[model samples]
Target: MAPSLREGVSQARSFEFLRLGRQAPWLVLGLGLLLGPGAFPHRARAAPASGADPAALLEQGREAYEMLECPKAVASFRKVLAHPKATPAQRVEAYVGQAWCQVVEGNEALARETLQKALEIRPDYPVSPDLSPKLAAVLEAAQRDFRARAKVEIDLDVTARGAPPELGMRVRDPAGQVNEVLVRYRTDGEWREVAAHSEGASLWTARLEGAAAGTLPLYVETKNRYGFVSGREGTAESPVAVRVEPAAVSAALAPPAATGAASGTALTPLAWTAAGLAVATVGAGTFFGLKAKEEEARFNGDPSQFGSHDEALAVGRSAQRNATTATVLFVSAGVLAATSGLLFVVDGSHGPAGDAVEPGFAAAAMPLHGGGLFALAGRF
Candidate 1:
């Protein structure tokens, strides 16, 4: 090999070793962790106070875990961390609890990192004896794996369902183009990658999208300029399970039910009102129409009866009022009738053959505040 190439190879190996050196402490810790619970050489921190007990939260997380509600369990563990006066031991408990959940949720890398954090808080921390052997193994592997890589801080989104499943994940993203965050999702037995862009300081996000309202599995990773990848990886410890469900319609935002009938014959209130308005307007039109015709006859009966120009003008004015009133009522009747007809047709289409609304009687005389005759009967 040329001296220059040899020198380049040497430099590459040196960089690799240097990188491995930085990870050495975590590796040693991971090996010790492999010894299993009650074996670490650190003192036990006292449990939290009764008033600030984290045990309940731990139990809550545990129950969620057993039920395969990893997201809920993660939440409980987070609450433990947020507890007002959680002790170091309690904090460790929370960390471990979350790690356990992360493993089951297919975020094995995250689980590993969490366990490492717990170990930092208490090097001698032991696994809970109450944990099942299967879970113990998961925890064991996660801790062992953490030694292999450094982890970035992350927050996972676990919404049950919302518009496109409110994909909100917060993770530490270095502020540079050289490092890129990528989210990979597994669907239909295929893995696809999507770029996760920076949202804020150290926050990278990729909105999760689902197809056909189903479950999706996805994980986040970051690649540096050096081609080194670090981030959460799915393992038995963290099998990402996200359910994509149809978006719920809030009562406030729900679309109105069709005025049309499910069986094809139901009429909306508007449709019914339109029909009544058409009938009422038609009735008015008929009455006015007759009055107009009557006035016309009276005028033709004796044009000479008007003795002066003023008298003729007076008769003409009366005829004009009659004509105008009749014209308005007739126009209104045509419009309302058309509207009602359209409504009725639409309502009928929504109903099944047997569900069509039976003919209803026309508005029986509307009762006025004071006794009055709206209409005794229709002539036409």
Candidate 2:
């Protein structure tokens, strides 16, 4: 016969009572008291879910959440919420945890949406209340930390002939922790960064807004996490002066400079003139040297062997005249070549010239002058 439900329950309770009574001392010892078959509680058993290690799994999910592992954290939290025994509070916490992970992963819009769902689960959730203050603190810290990187760019205008000017920077700070960096004007003082950041060997960039042209004073202040503020002052910064003159001013300046050049031109006719003089001097000197050699050859022979005394004297006089003329022409050529070279160097410094004087002219003239001098000495 089938057992009645009441009788079955009564038998079960009686067996439990008998087991407990015998194991009173063992119960006190807290061992082996519930080992007997009749001591088992009657409850429906459920199959273990796949891959479930609830405690360790939940802890892993929380760690991923803190590390901003959005997808993994969301998956884990979803798993926890699917558990049959998950309370309303636990479900709400899971939603909020997923939302925080999203925020850290830069999905602000999704984070807000997830947070709305969390709020729906508990109409007055602490997540929203707690998040506001923390988010505000982060933004404030970013702003304050970014302030130390303020920098100004300078631009200058000056006359073309004016002295090359340097840029100067002045920073004023009431506190002394921040320091100023000295920078030279690069490419007309273009926009540049004033600070750098490091993230575990990775470099991060800070944003720099546009800088206005002209002289400006900038201040930089830095603070530690504990709110100790210090500032530094830098030297004043000025733009390189760029000179822009009216057409009239440029025209007026042109004529006087041209007149000066005209007068200078009279001093140096043409490179060919100097070259011709040098060639003529060399030729004259060569002629004298040859004549001298001939005279010496004649003198070395018997005294009465070749020419009349008058003929020899006339040859000697001609050689001396050629030598003297060669000396004068060679000296003049050297002076002219030197003057031309100096003018060319000066013109090169100013700007592009219509005609560039070659250094070869001076080089050629030097050798010619030396040849002429040597020929003159030979004549003596």
Compare the candidates by TM-score and give the number of the best one: 1
Candidate 2: minimum summed lDDT over ten consecutive residues — where? Answer: 361-370
lDDT per residue, candidate 2, 278-300, as tens digits?
Answer: 56666666666666667656655
User: How far does residue 48 in candidate 1 sit from its true spot (Å)?
Assistant: 66
- Predicted candidate 1 versus true structure: per-residue lDDT over 1-380, tens digit per residue: 55698899999999999999999868755633443233212334434323325766776665565455678878878988998877777787788767766655567677777887775555434555655565566666754554344345556554323564444456654322127677777766677678876776665556555533567777666665444454454533366775555664322233334444344444566787987888888888788778777777777677677788787777667877988897898898888888888876676544455444443322223232234323332111
TM-score for model 1?
A: 0.25
What local lDDT does model 2 show for residue 376? 14
Error of 2 at 196 (Å): 64
RMSD of each: 26.1, 26.1
Query: The CA-based lDDT of model 1 is what?
Result: 0.61
Best by the lDDT measure: 1
